[model samples]
Target: MSVTVREVATPEPGRGEVRVRVHGSSVNKGDRLVMMGTPYVMRLALGLRAPKHFGLGQDVAGVVSAVGDGVTRWQVGEAVFGELTLGAAWAEEVVAQADQLARAPKNVPLAEAGSLPVAALTAWQAVVEEGRVEAGDRIVVNGGSGSVGSYVVQLAKARGAHVTAVVRAHHADRAQALGADAIVDAELEDFSATDARYDVCIDVAGSVPMSRGLRAVKQKGTYVVVGGPTDDPWLRPLLRPLGWMLRGAFSSRRVAVFVARPTPERFAELAAWVEAGRITPLFDSRCTLDELPQALAELESGRRRGKVLVEVHHRV
Candidate 1:
């Protein structure tokens, strides 16, 4: 009943699909929530009993083993990576929609490349697409030490924005080292009441007050959310990055919700960032498939400093 790899028929690529021999898969916080089958709501899609999708991982990096009809953007043996909807990534082979996968940078390791899919896209969408943030803009990234938060700091800096990161005192050094112009130890400082308001805000941690977060941004400034879970799953929805986004738009301050979709363009840009050395991998370690349960527990504890990758190459 576990999401362990088993002997199954090798799935052939359908039109617009590619059969990928999975090398590595990066774990997500959402993956942990679904795995726990929390609040009985996640089970509806994951499975009423066991997970419908047997493979556990959602973000993947691997080589294209076979390309199906109408697939022209890639070829066999090419390294590619992307995020998946119903994760089948904890396997030796997976069928991926061509549009969701992008060519990995030649210089980046496959294991680290898998880390880009969800987190990087979330940062890019918040800063690039929805936030419409520009250089010299003053920005605040709440939970700036988390997976997506780290990327937001780097991306905001690349855009020439003056970035402030709200993280724990323990994580202030790491966030600052990642290029945050200013660091706020939320554990020790009052972020909302600070006179230093921002032109834009990206909430990836969901730890700050909803209304207070909106107020933290200057008039005509924008706020976007990217994370989705907390201790209480139900409240997590309202407190999530998306829910905060909805509440922001209705208020006088501009608010936008971004569910970072798996797109080729975004994936390509992230890969380029990695290639150019503009974005470095924040991957900390790899957890085997058997360690999934413990890993999920650790993630829920809210202490993981970086991406926890799941190695899927053992099936070979």
Candidate 2:
């Protein structure tokens, strides 16, 4: 798929919406999925022939430039960050529902904060909501050095759970720095083949077999699927999640395919965590708006270490 930056009319906020002057946005796996229109099943909602939305961004951080009627929670100049339910955050200005946004972290640059919403929220749901992680729980996070996995390691640690991060040898130190108690170098060993069992197994890499992940979990434990192989254009990514759902019916272990639902409350809590220093955004690299196509390619190349940020407005 080809992408190019084009000029368009600035949008106005409708009722209960606000227009933001976007400072930052980032490339996410979801953006790539949407751009590729993959898993084929997703195309049912995205579009049958082509994507309904041409813009390819979801995370946004910026200052509110205008507000619509009935919106009172935010003012014209409040710094905010949130997920756009639809794509289009790649542009200079975006109009979003006021309820979907939360105040941007004061300690971080808005560009960096833009990388947090989707990745952090996905981790939040996996560890807190789906996994129900608690103190003393043993958890293994596959792909722990990636965007979502990085946050998963930190959040699980904050909950006092013992975290084992599965990453490439090059990223082992990076994962360790994020508070992982142990590191499984994917280049050298298979974590699933070990005798150790975990209270929760969060699979963000999706490179390992589902059966392996299922076997790694303790009885009645949870296996949360955050990502999967995107090589097959048909249903490779969805297959593992669907298999997990089917396995969940009879298995003692709880299997869940994690899909992030971004809400104002969740965003607020994430912001609070950022402010409190419980979690921080991890950036792999950055590019300007004009270079987003290359950034997306880099993200798709599976070579990036963390979030690849797109500096739209570049505010401090």
lDDT for each residue of candidate 1 in 63-131, tens digit (9 for 90 to 100): 999999999988999999998887778677899998889898778788777777877888889888888
What lDDT tens digits, residue by residue, belong to model 2 across residues 222-265? Answer: 98888888777877676777887888887899988868999989
Which residue runs does candidate 1 get wrong by more than 4 Å?
A: 1-5, 235-246, 290-294, 297-305, 314-316
lDDT of 2: 0.89
Give all TM-scores, in the order shown.
0.90, 0.94
User: Which regions of candidate 2 are displaced past 4 Å?
Assistant: 301-306, 314-316
The TM-score of candidate 2 is: 0.94
